[model samples]
Target: MSDQDSSSSSSSQTEEELDGEMDEETNGEVEKEESHRDSPAQSLSTFSSSLRAVIRIKQKYQVMKQRRQEMALALSGAGTFPGAPTRTSPKIFTFDGVTPSAFPMLSSSNPQKKKRRRRKRVLFPNRGTCRSPPKQERSRAKYCLYLLFAIVFVQVYNAIENLDDHVLRYDLEGLEKTLRREVFGQQGAVEGLLVHLKDYLSTYVHNKPLVVSLHGPSGVGKSHLGRLLAGHFRSVVGETLVLQYYVLHHCPQEADALQCAGDLSAIISEMVERAEEEEKIPLFIFDEAEHMQDEILDALWTLVASKQSNEYLNAIYLFLSNMGHAHITKHMLHNSSSTSMASGRHSALVKELTPVLRSSLEKLHQLWSEANILPLGLLEKGHVMECFLDEMTREGFYPDHSNIERLAGEIEYYPAVGGHEYSQTGCKQVVAKVNLL
Candidate 1:
């Protein structure tokens, strides 16, 4: 019985060992078959995937390249900016690692970049945006914009200041009234002055500057007219607008041309500076244009052409001269026939003399005339008496009717003998004798 139990146990143990070996062999066979089946498909799939990844990388590179080219063209026009950094090759990068400013097309205020930029800011505390490429462009553009604005403002100001004559309006009638009230004679001359000024007010005339030459014999109130002009304008505009220069006083016979020019330039520069404030033209009066040196005249010609001098001026230039008028001939006998003849003759003489200045101006090519010849004809006994009486009244010596007759008799009166003749003793002498009377 013991031998039988032992045999059974040995047989069972051998059978268990055999069963384990068979199970192991079957499992190995199954695994080998499965591996064999998967090998080719897996290898093929891996190759295809790698190819696709390479194609995608190339496509991304080409797209990035094109974008870079566009940005280069935009920022530098045709090429790269001088002294600025430029990239030569395309670089591969993940979205997380890409620089925010690497793409110029991106908006600066992108929300996604804010956290990354903030992190970078902490890491690079000394890196201010002033050295950034985009900001530099913006800074230059701002400067250009300011320069353009300034140029435009200057052009607009100049255009408005050089307005045309038709656009100008003033109390011309008021000026006429003022002249008529204060002055004794030369009604035609006064009217002519107004007409010229009207032309100057518009672009059609000498709008930048109008020079007026008052040609007449001495003591015909040429200087007086100038004073009246100064007074009239000073009252309305101000004292600064009018500049008076006596040709005899400022420019002596011995003074050189350069000296005269320097003196005039100083005056003109100062006048223009002051006139700029009011935006109105300034006035210049040359008391004796005839006595002005030839060199001074030439210098003036050059000066007038400069906008720096004439642009701010009133366009009114008055020159007083001893010569240039045709005196009235014949004595006033208080006879109607003689008076009529004398009046007719005087009218003819003035008519002829009016063109004389115009002709001279054309011949000399001188704007120096601002020319209009209005002869202050010889004052008749009546006119001189009127002037003398006016003077006496102003001096607190109101002469009665008989006193006036006696004063007239005491005054020597010389009349123009002919159209070509002039008064040897104009009212100039008559003025001195008034105090004696």
Candidate 2:
């Protein structure tokens, strides 16, 4: 029984130890539950802090990604530069917040390419554009056109100057002064002749030769005027260009008409050919044309009407005739009395007598119709006295007015109105009378 009781005591001790250990375990579990219930605010605060930190990190990541995308866009086209290394995708970037320019290897090549491209743009601005052709060539062509126009203008100016020179070489002004000074008592005849000369000689080109016909009575200065022209032309153009042919002297009344016509044509042709070779205009005087036969006139008409050659075109022909002397004298003595009335009478005579004379001359031959008719009017006693004075002076004798008046009075006069006597034989005997003096 003592051994049993000792065992029970030990058992009880063990049971108490066991109860203490259980009690300790239950208290630790209670403490742990109380601590957990009391720290709820701290745990909630830590969870909120962690969530805010995560949100901040996510926003920073998003911002960095956006900036990287923008940087990539900005640097995207860099690889497209000519002579640079090409990339499959231009948007090359790293998400480490490091730009492409940050690396020396990439930036060094990029600046050189950029400088090269800028240099290319500055140097070859229009290298591959629409205006790439040669501008200098077009400018040169424009300059050539300007030069061509200038050349043409200069040529035309020279042509005009040459024409002026041609007209000025004729010395027509000298001829006009000489006619006004020397010719007398026939103011209208002188003026008409001067006008025709000026008109014809102003230009060297003409379709036909000029033909002038002088008609009047005997001793009315027709032959005198012809002699004056022959002398004047001989002095002016040198004697080689003047041909004076008198019907009584060249082809006399007794000569064969056909032979005379042939000889006259040959002589005229030779003279014209010689004058043309010398580049000179010739003067042909055919005096006493009324005495010319039909065959001689026909030959002259053929020669004068020739337009076959330029040599035949440049000439002057004077035909002195007495065909209309009766009409010319009647018109002059009836109309004109003094020198003052001479000019008025001359215009009327030309108006009235030109048609009458032309018709009369056309009846003889059509060649005379084309002739420019100049009528010589009758001279008054005063004109006859002046003629006497001129002849006396030319013969180296003293020209006393009384002696000239006596010599003029000796000549017969036509019985006219107002007792204004007109000389019947005007200056025809003045030279012979002066010789006697």
Candidate 3:
């Protein structure tokens, strides 16, 4: 009984050991299967990243190729040689894991050696040279250039077509009479000045500056003559003749003689720069000379003198002052001790100038000595009457000589209360008398 019981125990122990070994083998097989599945998924991820990189490289190559072609076209238009050709397409290659035997295999050779005999050579072709772009890209570039030039040309032509002539409005009849009396009358000192002016203008045309001063009393008409001369020059010279007319009233409220220097300097610099660039001379006309600041006058002197030194600024400089010849002469003497004093006294005479301009009086004297002074006088009785008659004619009113003479007599006798006073009643009476005639 003891032997049978011991045999049963040993059999049971052997069965338990066999079951443990089978479990270990099954677990090992499961681990091997998991590792094999993970390998394929990792390979797929690597292939996807490589494909993306290749696509990016292809896109960059295409962009570079397009830019190269555009540059070539631009260089051709600029009359320059085109650059070297560039690759447009990506390259492709192929390889096989096979090789050819050096010697023919005999029927008696080893089977393994015979099986490994055949091999294939790898090939890599340049795909960039194989393909050509369509001709439409070249045509499109040419069309763009043509459109650009056409638009630019049209804009330039339109700008030139929109310019108009510039003219200022004033009393034309009064201006004409003022000029005739000052330039042609018997007692006219302006007659000698006229001859000198003609010579000066002739010299001015040959690139010489003409500095002229017109001085007279209030009613003697220096401003009217100045405007007339400016108009005459503009009418004959078609080139850009810029006119800068300065009056005492035109000065800004904040400006004093010294403070106005910057403004005046800027104006002169701008004018000179314009003249230099455009090849045009500028005419500077200063009226109401009595009101000009001393500093302003100094600036003008500097500009004129500096321009005189330069070959370019042979432009006309006109000065119209109500200050008489005595005033002008005294100012000149105080400013300069040169022969300008003799010339100022002999060439021009008016009444008297203000003493405020004494500081730059020498510059004024030098200017007068070098320049031609034209003195304007009052109108003659007949010329005055003729001017009135002409004004009446323009208004569509005709007057006989007898009636005109009666009206002239009234104007002459009551001149202080009537004609020259610029009254509405005076103008109406003159108009009525002309209508009756």
TM-score of each: 0.52, 0.62, 0.41
Order the candidate numbers by lDDT, best to worst.
Answer: 2, 1, 3
Ranking by TM-score: 2, 1, 3
Better of 1 and 2 by lDDT: 2
Tens-digit lDDT string for candidate 3 (1-437): 34334434443444355445444544554455456545756676565655665565566556654554464344334442257332222223323222445334643476555454532112444557659764654567788899999999998766544221111122233334556654322134445435544454332233456677766544344665566667755554433455645655557453566767667677666765665564445566788776777677667767666544343355667788755545543343353333532343423322223223333344544454545555543333454456457657767766567656667566432232112222112222444556565
Strongest candidate by lDDT: 2
TM-score of 3: 0.41
Q: Tell me the tens digit of each residue's lDDT in model 1 across 1-437.
A: 34434444544454466556555654655555556545776676565655665565566556654554454344333333467554332235457435867775675656659867887778755556658555433468889999999999999877766653234434566778888876655666677777776666644223356767777766667887888888767775588878888877886765465688778877776876676666666677888777777666766666664564445445566777765443222222222244434465544445655665566545654654444555555554565566677778888887676776666566555543433223344457656777775
Q: Report the lDDT of model 2 for residue 368.
A: 90
Which residue runs of candidate 1 sit more than 4 Å off their true CA positions?
Answer: 1-170, 201-207, 305-314, 325-350, 360-370, 415-423
**Which candidate's TM-score is highest?**
2
Q: After superposition, how far is residue 365 of candidate 1 from its true place, in Å?
A: 7.7
